[model samples]
Target: MLIKRVPSAEAPLDLLLEADPSIDTIKRYLESSICHVATIEGETVGAHVIQPIGDGVYELMNIAVAPAYQGKGIGTKLLEHAVNMSRKLGAQRLELGTGTFGYQLAFYQRAGFRVISVERDHFLTHYDEPIYENGIQHKDRLLLALEF
Candidate 1:
């Protein structure tokens, strides 16, 4: 797979967000952040977006892989690409949030991210509609960060 910065409109990212409903937020992030897509066999299979939040830090706004392509390490490649890009852009750290209970937390952990904090009632208090997957509503957001 090859990773590159591509126009969000040009990437097949809808497939990524549909895999996890809360990731729907990614659409808005894509509109304004530095975005990238992963291509395999010339087809977009994954995407990531990074947004600057000042203090020399960037927020990992989104990272998603096509459902059919989830286990092939495409997300990891996309993340590594984002990290390298952040360093190139002179970012001192990267931060992101994910549901308190999900594979996503572990995925970021495996990528060398460490838990920095938690928003105790983020999803429950911030979202108007309960964002759920597999019939479970997400209630908290665990913040994770990595130093560049």
Candidate 2:
């Protein structure tokens, strides 16, 4: 597998949408964010977006792996690449938002990110459609950060 930066225009939107449901939100961020892709044999299998949010902080706006490639450590590789890229770009911290509960939250925690705060009703207010996992609705957003 190869992980490399690519223009936002070249990002695999379908794969990104697997992680972030809102197309409008993704497009808005993609305008200024740096996109990276993990490919194997010239096929994109995973992707992540990182945006510098000033003050030496960067936000991991999105990350996703193709369903067929899920559970093969592709997401972890993409995340590690994002962190390294952020460090190289002088980021003092890396942050991201995810559902308050889910495999995603645990994934970040395992990667050394700690929950900084919670945005209550974030999904309820932001998403046009409700997001549910394991039969429970996601109503809050957990803001997590990894300090370098």
Candidate 3:
């Protein structure tokens, strides 16, 4: 597998939608962000996008691994790459928002993210439709950050 930086605006829509259902939301930050992709034999499998939100701080707005390759550590690799890349770019902190409960939340935690706060009813108010994983509905956005 190989990891490389790419133009965030042109990131594959299907893959982006896999992690974030709303095109509008994706468009909100992607156009101006930095994107990294994970590939195997030249086939794209996962992607992550980050954009600066403040001085020395960046927000990981999107990250996903295709269903066919979800559990193979590609997502974690991409994350590790992001962390290193962020440091190179002089970032002091990295942040992201995910559902309060889910593998995604746990994934970030395992990567050294700590809960900062919760945006109550974020999904109910922002998403056009409800998001469910493991039969559980997503209601709030769990704000997490990794401070280096």
TM-score of each: 0.87, 0.98, 0.96
lDDT of each: 0.81, 0.96, 0.90
Question: By lDDT, who's the top model here?
Answer: 2
**Winner of 1 and 2 under TM-score:** 2
lDDT score, candidate 1, position 105: 79
For residues 21-65, what per-residue lDDT tens digits would candidate 1 score against the true structure? 544565666677888888889887888888888989998887888
- Residue-level lDDT of model 3, residues 38-114, one tens digit each, is 88999999998888889999988989999999999889998998888888888999999999888888899999999
**Candidate 2 runs further than 4 Å off:** none
**Cα deviation of 94 in candidate 2 (Å)?**
0.0
Model 2 C-alpha lDDT per residue in residues 32-135, reported as the tens digit of each score = 99999999999999999999998999999999999999999999999999999999999999999999899999999999999999999999999999988999
**Model 2 clashes, total count:** 0
lDDT of 1: 0.81
Judging by lDDT, tell me the better candidate of 1 and 3. Answer: 3
Cα deviation at 51, candidate 3, in Å, is 0.6
Q: What's the CA RMSD of model 3 in angstroms?
A: 0.9
Ranking by lDDT: 2, 3, 1
Residue 120 in candidate 1, Cα distance off native in Å: 2.1
